[model samples]
Target: MMFEGFLFVIHLFLHTYCQLQVVAQCFINLLRWWRVNKWNADIFLNQTKNLGKIPGHVSLMFLEEDTPVEDIVKPIVWCICLGVTTISLYDYYGRLRSKKLDIDKELREYYSDFTKNCRNSPKNQPSPRIQFVSVENGRTDLVYAARDIAQDLLNGVVKEVTKVNYQNYHKVFRNDHPDLMMKFGIHTTLAGYPPWPVHLTEIISLPTCHMISPYNFLDCLNRYFKIEKRVGK
Candidate 1:
């Protein structure tokens, strides 16, 4: 009975310590966000550039299905301003994917406002290419790829399963693999993001964000560069 009581006390202490750590980290993150928010988009990009290499393709995953379309646009615009060419937005379910058009329109408006206020010349900015991905996209692509592979095997196009290469799957899902994936919530579960594409991607998670604050977005990108991706090494 005494041993079990001691174990319970230890667990309580550990849990309390963890909660305090979380609170301290949250406070630090808030301060960083405040500082980053003061800078213009161009300035933030310039400062972050010195951190390391910028990602050409970025994936933003919102754990919540009901995340507002406007909130989704903020990060997309931030990616554009940071000179990221390809941006993918994802949610667990297909809810956000269904509103792709609305998000696209909002992105245009949001980016337009950003550009107008931006100190950088319009010609210097690169237009962002946005893709909305959901679990359904992955499911469909997997099904298509499997069917193709099966047909190839039956028709002697592919002799063995071991002979199938990345190219076979790439042909079915033509989207560029993301260089960096950022999750906008504390939840660690990927919530059904396509696994194949992100095998080598650097993923960073931030606290739950209802709106894409400038600091959190920029910090996430900065963190991406600092990570050493030693995949399968």
Candidate 2:
């Protein structure tokens, strides 16, 4: 009985000792982290490199800290004043040179003051609306495509062109009027095909083996008649 009692006391002391050692290690690790994090705050605040200059054109919202109101206001003011000032200056000069309005020193000064007022006025910046036109919606491109479709038809004006020259027509057409080209359908492969266009496959393959190249030669398409003229004349 005495030996058993003695073993129990020794086991209790070893368990308590192990638990205390674990707690002490935990406190040491906690203390190290606390010091590291505290020092990191100071290191970040003093790091004055890329933080000062923002990337790209100014976006309203991305920043590490609350941005100074002045930073946002200044560029907006510059852009607004510069835009109005340029228009006003152009008008003022144009009127003077064209003799449309009698230009006096007072009028020039008044124009400058008006531009200044427009910049300093702070009514929340309005969003600029942008409108876009696509190649499929352009005027000149549509008209050019229409003209080309009829060019080989009826008139017999220019040499009948092969489908391979589609892009060639498009390039020249766009160069003359690019703004309208973007509004019309620039590319359409099967759009203008006639009901009998598939039969042109036979003419293209010669022996009607398969696949057509260069141009579809449907017998029904009047354009095919030009093949003889094109080869000879």
Candidate 3:
């Protein structure tokens, strides 16, 4: 009985110590977040000059359900303002996919502010394109691509199996694979994002995205540009 009591006391102490450590880490993270100043298009424009390269196609993956549409749209607008040509907004489920019109409406509103505040004319920027990709879309794209390839083969359109490459598949979908994927979640796993497209994509995991500030967005971009991709070397 005494030995059991002593073991219980040790367990209690360890649990309390772990809880305190978690709290201390949270406090440190909060302090770091507070130190990052909010940025705008003007700041982004300046930062772009210093950046080595910008991702032409970027994907924002939201793992959490019920994420506010504004939270999703704000980053898209920022990406546009920063001159990303294409953007993909992905959620684990198809909830956001059905809300495409709503997201577009919100994007336009946010974009107007970016144009107004930015020194460079919006006309000078490449027209930004966006897609709402869900888990279903990933599966559907693969299945449909296979079906199409099979049909084309039967019709003698595709001469060789080797011809059915990623380029052809991507052309069928009319979407470019993401160059950089930003996953907004505390969870480590990607929650089963389409494997084929992101084979060579750069992925950065972030905390649960609420109102994503420009500082956080630009910080991700900075991290992406810093990576040295030694492909097949």
Candidate 4:
């Protein structure tokens, strides 16, 4: 069991480390190579060019230095990944332990025990609603990034509520979630317009993917802007 737990830890950390690296790489690339004309977006280049080939040999151009060396120098990526995995493992373990404890608790012996289902019934569902205050669909990546940033603002609590003001939630979403770009259902290269995806149908059918759920607000907005942009092009 301990060995299994250790392996789980290693896996979780590596995953997060990889994710961070990917996010960092994509962000840098977007700032540099992803511009309208492959512009030299060298914001960091000017800041650290004088630092020399030390301090893990970090580079502003493409982080090419440390990544290759990390593979040899104790495999830093793996270490970081392991660390992330350890935290995830502990969190899951704690939750499981709590659930097990709850299950093991002795029932009220001499009193009538009533078990109540905690789930919200059909009537408790949020009304079928779509609120799109704004939409921008120039690039799916940009839209995806915005959605991620918006979602993160709620810090997972957004999963339960409605009505969002970006001021309160922008930090949580920011560039943290690259996976959100994946949620748009297609990877759009900047060369030209990407082929229309069938998933757009679901968006068009009712302007939402998950019934009356609010998760698709920004998602739909993204598509809306993308469509308009394509038409304007």
Candidate 5:
């Protein structure tokens, strides 16, 4: 009976050790796969740049309010320097009372400074246009405005609909659409960004927006290039 009990203890220990070994091996393999995927993504990005088809418009989404405006603006500057045309910045938490107004004021000030500095710089080109929209509040306003206009047209209060096209509707919403949306958060959720512009927009979620760098921006562009956009086919 003593010998049997000792054998049972040894068997349990061996089983536990094997299970731990399996888990460790899985973790190592996952790490290896991640490294390889990153390497491949880098190579693909370089090749795409060589092909000269960078994303035209990029949107960034984040929740934090205290994140320095410079952290957001610097990335936009870098994207513009890289020849991206339109940049959209969305603050999810800006929907709170007075937050959106504060954000807008700060952005306007930053943009004014940025443009002033760019004009003074010798290497200045046409800077990309930056637009800030609070996801929840802005979208609601846009939808309401559109509904009012449509209602007016139906009631014949506004005569003569000159154009009946998608572009006309786009104009109504001010044409603030994005080609790729980069989300800076732990979760992959969109956090209530406007649904109208993202019909085909590629969303890339990053771990966090605390310490964004130029390389991180480049990686986003790389990921954007990997997406094959099939527009409503």
Candidate 6:
């Protein structure tokens, strides 16, 4: 009778152990499922949020002194597809004007090929107006800024006119300011972008410009949206 009792206790213990093992496995699976579902949900929510918000204007600055204009065309096209109305590309070296003919030729070829290949080409949609500016333009604006300050002083526009008045006058040359500006290079410096437009603009730095993908452009837009801009308010 004692031997039978011992056998019965052993069986009970084995059964309990098996049940515990099953429970532990189930718990682990449940945790994995929860994590996977949560990750998928977060991705879906982010995509939905980005779709609702689109920047009106975007700007790109090539921090490197002699960046080729050809390297910028793809990024500009990607920005246009994102529904940007205005795009300003700035290069510190001012070589863009010299390469204008080559850039124009390449752009025309790209447009032709894009219309032929892309089934949902943005050609039918409103395209962004692209403008190229240089550090020289910003320097020239300093002269305008000085002139405006003198005029404001002479006319007594305000009791105490400061740098803000000068910035306001500098806007006359280019009215459409960048909503978001991305600097392409190792560093985050503006490299002489006009100060007036950047007061409210969000700036981001990209590692490089060569062989940049559309996803990189989208990532910059995403980063822009994630920031909270006070605009000195």
Candidate number achieving the greatest TM-score relative to the actual structure: 3
lDDT by residue for model 3 over 166-221, one digit each (tens)?
34764222547688999998888867677777877899988977757777887888
lDDT of 4 by residue, 1-233 (tens): 99999999999999999999999988865643332122111321232234332121110111121222111211111112112111000111123223333322421110011112212112232322111111122245356646766666668645543334432433222212111111111222221212221112212222111111112322332443354322223
TM-score of each: 0.71, 0.19, 0.76, 0.17, 0.59, 0.63
What lDDT does candidate 3 reach at residue 185? 87
Clashing pairs in 6: none
- Per-residue CA lDDT of model 1 for 145-171, tens digit only, reads 788878888999877765336345643
In TM-score terms, candidate 4 sits at 0.17
Q: Higher-TM-score candidate among 3 and 5?
A: 3
List candidate 2 segments past 4 Å from native: 41-233
Worst 10 residues of 6 by lDDT: 36-45
In model 2, what lDDT does residue 31 have? 63
Q: Which stretches of candidate 4 lie over 4 Å from their true place?
A: 34-233
Q: What is the lDDT of candidate 4?
A: 0.27
**TM-score, cand. 3 vs. native:** 0.76
The candidates, ranked best first by TM-score, are 3, 1, 6, 5, 2, 4
Clashing pairs in 1: none
Residues 156-208, candidate 6: write the lDDT tens digits: 87566665554466633356677788889997577877776778888889998
Model 3 alpha-carbon drift over 4 Å, by segment? 1-39, 164-166, 170-175
- Candidate 6 deviation (Cα RMSD): 16.9
Question: What digit string (tens of lDDT, one per residue) describes model 5 on residues 1-233?
Answer: 99999999999999999999999989966764553234322243343456357667888787665665545555665555556678777877554334546545765554454445332331345767666656554567667667767887899877755434333544223555677888877775777777777887888888766546556777777777777776775
Q: C-alpha displacement of 1 in model 6, angstroms?
A: 99
Judged by whole-model lDDT over C-alpha atoms, candidate 2 comes out at: 0.31
